[model samples]
Target: MLGSQTQTPPKEASSSITDKTKIKARYFMIWRWHFYAGLYVIPFILMLSITGLVMLFDDEIEMITYQDELVVMPEAMTLPVSIQLDKVQTMYPHGTVTQFIPSKAIDRANKFDVRLADGRSVLVTINQYTGDILGEIDRSDSWYQLANDIHGTLLLGQWGDYLIEIAASLSILLIGTGLYLWWPRDHASIAGFLKLRFSNTRLFMRDLHANFAALFSIVLLLFLLSGLAWTSVWGGKLVQAWNTFPVYYTWGDKPESHLTHADLNHGSEKELPWNLEQSVLPESNQHIHGAYTSSETDKGYVATQNNINIDSIVKQARGLGFTQYKLFLPQSEKGVYTLAANSMGGDITDPRLDKTTHIDQYTGDVLVDVTWDDYTVLAKLMAAGISLHQGDVSVFNKALNAVFCLVFVLISLSGMLMWWIRRPSGKTRIGIPPHFESEGLWKAGIAGLFVVAVCFPLASVALVLFGLADWLMFKPRR
Candidate 1:
């Protein structure tokens, strides 16, 4: 009975060995497809990686090149918001003002945006006292912008963007298959996982490729995934899911009767307007009259009801601890002068109130005042994300971004090197692994399913065509 059991055990072991062999063969076939795809798409991936690295430190480069224009005044009085607007208008009479970004930090001093008569937008930094245009920045002429153009679309626009998306998708597949290939079947040696002797050229190359990929795998994945999210359909869906909160801006109806600057200062307590009704005050009346206003005692003061001059308004804003303030002049009969103040106390990264004051052009009465602290939670998050992304959060953030750029360049170079070394040669060598092959129709079918699952429409179509070719070349044997 013991001899018979031993004989049965041998037969069972033989069957199990055969099953394991078939499974490995199947995996090998899938790996061949991945290898070929990586070889074909590597050049495109290399270009994207290189260009993306340059774009990471775009702000630093801009600062270095435009030092004269970017420098700020040592001690300029906070000019009236309207006076600043008038100065900008006087300097560029043909250009129309689009947006006035109140100074938030040293980098933002006297800077504002204007759209020229020729449809080109220009970012200008001006002298607050003389209103002289100190420096004009054209994004079209910027090297960083040029690099962004290449990184985003290879300078081919939407078509380039799509190509990048395809490359990213292929990279995911390549990494997955590469990881599987790296896994040893039963080798217990540490040398197999990490260390490799440089005596054999092929082994050195293979090890170099595998080790680099393993080391920077997570960062490379994040870089590719974030980029794809910007350019691909599925990636867009992923980003949308990540940012699910809605961004909404509410504006009140235009006031029925315009209030003059005089109407605001002497308004009767009996006729004090509703909060919503008073919300449309022109830009000039928004600053806190005193150094500070408490929530309980200053409800009336919060209403736009002042007729201060633009120069006085700027002084008041500065006095109230606002380092950066921008004033806008009303364009038409019903337009309100606007004053925007940023008062986070010189810490760009710190969250603070963004105050907007609307003052009646005719009357000096304040119409509407809104604060940054009053924004919805989602809106605040979005603002902070944008600031961080733009390298505008703080000096420390800008330095960190520069380091991130250097890291990105290293990652791209390492990835390209890995791809080049692992490229297959037609000749089969002893140390170099030969291409994997499919044994039966079922194995081929599984490979097709995997290709379709990863590549979506392109792989699905390619698989169908491959199947058709197979049928024509070798029909099933009965």
Candidate 2:
């Protein structure tokens, strides 16, 4: 019986062997792709994590840095908005007041964003209660803005943008394959994937990397997606096109302005909410029955009328159920008055509270009123995701994001170390995972490659380069 059993394997044994081989093949394929993606993602992810962590506390940092300018005692008799504008306009006669940001809390100074005639922007602080100009800061010189530029572009301008897009694209593959590999095998306890194995150096780091990455996998993915949704190619060109807010009504035949909200972000740290990512702006029409609209006169704009007109607009904003919103002043001769608020850090600090309104500068007609509910399904998701990613939504979210960033830094560094330590000694070539020959690899990969290429063109370019190298030097020899 033993000799017969040895000579002819049982059907169950044969099936088990086939399943094991299949799992091994799948593991190697995933591992290979994960390695390829990591090579490009590690440096950029580290930079993003670091800069993001810095930007998470931007509000608090700015408050601390500009405390003398931002603070005020509680008082009911606040200065009129026009008086504050007059004070700033007179000081920088060469400047135009673009936006007035009120403190969400009453007991604080108001901010005026002025565009100087010399082509610079400055943040002017005026005490609402005292009506005194407190301090002025050149907007571009802010530390957070510099860090934000680096986070977005590595300080390399457009080239930096492309590099980040490629890295961000490949990161999708990195995290996806990582989760696949991170799944516990054979119904094993959480020890391998969740619990860190510190018994051995390589195993300890590997386990630590796996466990932490697995823990933060969902959060990491959300951050990556939100960040990508802001990128030039994937988010701007592909996603934002279909996800942009659609205009529903028009008061006149006035053609929309060529500029979108993005035009406003040209020289500023503030960004438009994701919902307005691609909405065409409406232009001011001369037909609305009004003499220069609200708070206006025939001889150029001035600071007077006790803000009775804008207060009505504020009342209207309140009537629309807005508790907190920013009133961005007209930017040009035909610029509109924009009352904006979103969950982003600038305003109410809750993504669910998003609201934006654009009123004609010449006629004071409501051009557009968009609330959270008006956002596209994709834009709504991006709004919430972006708030979480920015860590401005909650203390817990901010702390969790910080932890994830730290863990990612550890995972990236330790991953490199693991490869270095475990590499085949004395080998001239990279000690890549053993890519055992599988007839289905190229065929199976084609579908994924095509999908990635369609979604992220820059990453596709990287993959094409890698594919060429693989076919030339790394393809398994039969």
Summarize candidate 1's per-residue lDDT along 1-478 as a digit string, tens digits.
7767754458889989778777777565555545555554566666765554466566567778877777666555656556776677677777766445565454445766666776666767775545556788885667766776777677787777666666676676666766776666555323556666587665665666666566656656655654554454544343333332112433345353354322331111101111112222433222333332222221111222334445555555555555555555443434565655432211234444555566554445556655565555543454444344434566786566555545545544554565556555543321122333435847566765676556444334444554464456433321
TM-score of 1: 0.61
Model 2, 363-455: lDDT tens per residue? 456788777877777878888888888877778988988888888798888888777777775433576677765667677788888988898
Q: Which candidate is the best by lDDT?
A: 2
Q: Model 1 misses residue 209 by how many Å?
A: 2.5
**Candidate with the greatest TM-score versus the true structure:** 2
Each model's lDDT comes to: 0.52, 0.75
State the weakest 10-residue window (summed lDDT) of model 2.
297-306
